[model samples]
Target: MARITAGVGSSHVPLLGVAADTGKDADSYFGPIFEGYEWTRAWEREEKPDVVILVYNDHASAFDMKIIPTFAIGCGERYMPADEGWGPRAVPPVLGHPDLAWHIAQSLILDEFDMTIINEMEVDHGLTVPLTMMFGKPEAWPAKVIPLAVNVVTYPPPSGNRCWALGEAIARAVASFPEDLNVQIWGTGGMSHQLQSPRAGLINREWDNRFIDSLIGEGQEARQISHIEYLRETGTEGIEMVMWLVMRGALGARTRALHRHYHVPCSNTAIGHLVLLPDNGEQPGTDDDRALATT
Candidate 1:
């Protein structure tokens, strides 16, 4: 039986790269608060997952406000990096496992979970920043990634509960794969900080703490929290916390959190990291996890 061996979460703050490239110990800004990534690094090495289903919010990168899909699956062969204010980073284009992606899509649709199927797309900083932090470079991703893009920029986006349901759908999709593969699903972004509107730079430690705790403790139950409550209490952009639930939902009811970190003011963002290991005792990831589409 296929099982999730590891899971990771992180904030995809663009400012981190801006700071790093400018030659600053970027960690100093968030050092006091973000204690999650350091632990996640160790967990990544220990688990060594092969494929990671990365769940992240697109910041008007691939999908615009015009047409947004609550859940978008990448079924493309390659994804171009987006052009931020600066020119697009000259990193490797993201390659996809189209066959597995189609399998996941077909299974979810059959399960009554509809999703936007994307065959050609370009991922923005929201996806790459976290990858750079986790894999050390855009060209050297430790594992093949299945991009699960969520729309967080639009008003009245998918509810937190809806994101959780997507996670459950993803789990069923992966579990039903006929081929044998060990996979790790990653949920990136969020930990109580706002990046848009006048409330930008807002960091709510109280809310961040509550969210991280519930993610580890309550699991899917955390989805019960309403988006209105999150926006009112944690700030609108902080709604990205809903994306984190996707990771927790993929995890077993009980998991061993290997490490965690959090930091604030990481270049106009809150930086956070989390790592989880499935308690069932399996190797982190297998070759099948990285298999590309077999035509």
Candidate 2:
């Protein structure tokens, strides 16, 4: 049976991609940002999953005012990188797991979380930047992916509780799949920075760290946070943090945080990345964990 091996939460800012692509990651301005992911990169070698369920928001790349599905799942065999304003990032096309995506879509609908199923769509930086951050610019991604796009760009996005519950439903769907697959749910975007209006430069590290603390905690307190609170305190654009709750909820009630990194001033955002391993007697995804194993 398929089980959720881990959850990854990260901030997905477009400029970060540009910085990495331009080979300026070690520059003073970007060094802190790139350094934050070093732990994750080290941890990934030992904890790689068969597939990643990437959760991100569409930045007006695929869906315009014409349509906005509160939650959408990509069930296609492949997805091309989208050109958001400037141009598409120089990255490999994303390979999809259509079989698993279809199964999750069907399961979600039956579980009462109606999702907009997409067989075709261009993926924007919101999705690609996180990939670039975690996996780097590989000739091909090390693992297949299932894109789960959430509507955080527009008002009336899924509530925190709703996103959390949907994640729980996805966990159930993954477990019920007959195939033996290692699955990882990755929630991307937000660490308290806004990129629109006069409030574009806002960065609330205290609040962001508190949210991160709650996420690492073995409790649902973070899921109980309201959208209004996220908007009012974390900045309007900072409200994207709701997507992280999805990753948190999918990992069950207990988790062992394997690695965490947080840094400021990634263009107009505060970058955050976290790696978590489920604590149900499952082995940690690292050689160090194996060496120190108590059980």
The per-prediction tally of clashing pairs is: 8, 0
Q: What does each candidate score in C-alpha RMSD?
A: 6.3, 3.0
Query: Residue by residue across 1-295, what tens digits does model 2's lDDT show?
Result: 9889889999998888989889998899988888788767766666777899999999998899999899999999999999988888889999999989999999999999989999999999889998888887689888889999999888888888999999999999999999999899999989887667888788988899888878775878888888888887788887788899899989888877767777777777788888876677565556546321110
Which 10 successive residues of model 2 have the least lDDT summed?
Answer: 286-295
Candidate 2, pairs of clashing residues: none
TM-score of each: 0.86, 0.94
TM-score of 1: 0.86
Q: Which residue runs of candidate 2 sit more than 4 Å off their true CA positions?
A: 281-295
User: lDDT for every model?
Assistant: 0.72, 0.86
Query: Per-residue CA lDDT of candidate 1, range 1-295, in tens?
Result: 4556667777887765554445453356643432344445544666666667889988777777578898888987778888887978656777777877898899888988778998987888888777666654434666667899887778777777787787778888888777666788888877676668888777887777777767664345678888787787777777887888788777766656656666665666566677665555444466423221110
